[model samples]
Target: MQSSHVDITKKSAYVDAHIHLDTYSGAAQAAIIQLLEDDTLPLDYVVAVSMGLKSSQATQAWARRYPQRVLPAYGFHPEQALPTDAEVAELLAWMDVHQAEMAAVGEVGLPYYEREAAAKQGNVFSREPYVELLEQFVQRAAAWNKPIVLHAVYDDAPLVCDLLERHNVRKAHFHWFKGDADTVERMAANGYFISFTPDITYEEDIQALARRYPITQVMTETDGPWPFEGEFTGTVTVPTMVRDVAAYWARLQRITEQEAAVLLRENARCCYGY
Candidate 1:
């Protein structure tokens, strides 16, 4: 592997566009701190995504502890059942009040995986509630003028794109994205951003995505605490892994590692306004 020209000794040129920092254990977090201090890990910042209101609060705490490195985004994830309307309202209110502190409205999207689970059980469920909840978050993102990190994949991505269009929310990021070519082209045409995970190394599908999307519209992430396979197997997911991911992306895009690092960092800044 070619050594990265991104000199983390002077300054960080890479960013983890999406992660759930609140979910990591204390010891793991300490390891991250040590790596950063030793300049072994060269990441500028991480966009910490929330699962729900409680997770949002904890993520905010992490942000406070690492004020310069951890950026918080509060929202509900779709993997779990939707919260009550009142609870949703409370979450929105919390986000609104802390808009100044947060970076984006994120980790919110339709339950694609849950839908698959329901089908395996011979159950059919409506996505209306998910759409409705996403609408609320989109509206908040618009009102707050904050970028939104989405988990929408495959067929659901089109619907998510519809809502973004309806709401006219332009600064959107689909993290760890997996979708059809048509949808990918649609998103690229709309100038939407996408972030790739470490899977880019071994997953040909993800490699194709990196090849198809313009470098300027791409970023990198570990989605840490969520393990990966390939070269990432068995190792605890950490932000430092992004260095290798960026290098792989550079190879795929036929650009130098430094160029890829700078482009990814700029993409993160543009998406999250950091």
Candidate 2:
């Protein structure tokens, strides 16, 4: 009956922390408002993510529109790739041109697609290309004092951590981490971050993960447009769903949701220098 009825007041500011904005530009602006419209949600900012080199343009534009709220991170996802060296070089050129446009490097890591496993997809799955590229790019970020928003996890998580350590990349956020205990321990010991999305709201494995690690080691995300399926009934996931995830973590950790929200927001800001 009233706006307050839709919004509830929570403690501290809220952040989606990590999201794919370019992929959902059709509803980007409207969704931004919707996610935090409820006073109960109280989102203060969002960390928009780029899934590819080209996605940077749209993502940056949208983030610029909401500079006070959306900070953009750009990169090329290992899930997709170009066919030749020239094409890869073209991508590198694009990154060079837009280096100043992003807050971090991300959504970029190893490929796990079936075709990539059999070489049916060729070199896209090979860590060689992106790993070498990251070697160069990581330094550029350090010179700029920007963090890296990582996508590699599971068996690949350890490798990502290794590179971050070798390059002295201090600010790293691994979204949707499902890595083994050894890897998780390394990340925790190294002070890297892992984000949980709607995936944890229902999945027992993710819930177990939440229980395995302390709340301070976790943050919230939606990985919008990437459905988690337990809920949402096959509907499109949006960054706003991150609110549910924040609450879920608080519940799992047996702390007030508001308290967890505060910690998560801090972690997000630290990763992106917000």
Q: Give a tens-digit lDDT track for model 1, residues 29-98.
A: 7776675455445678889999999999999998897886889999999989889989998998888889
Model 2 Cα lDDT, one tens digit per residue, 234-270: 7677766777888888788776667777777766766
Instruction: Please identify model 2 stretches exceeding 4 Å from their true place.
Output: 1-10, 25-41, 114-125
The candidate maximizing lDDT is 1
Worst 10 residues of 2 by lDDT: 1-10
**Using TM-score as the measure, which candidate wins?**
1
**TM-score, every prediction:** 0.93, 0.84
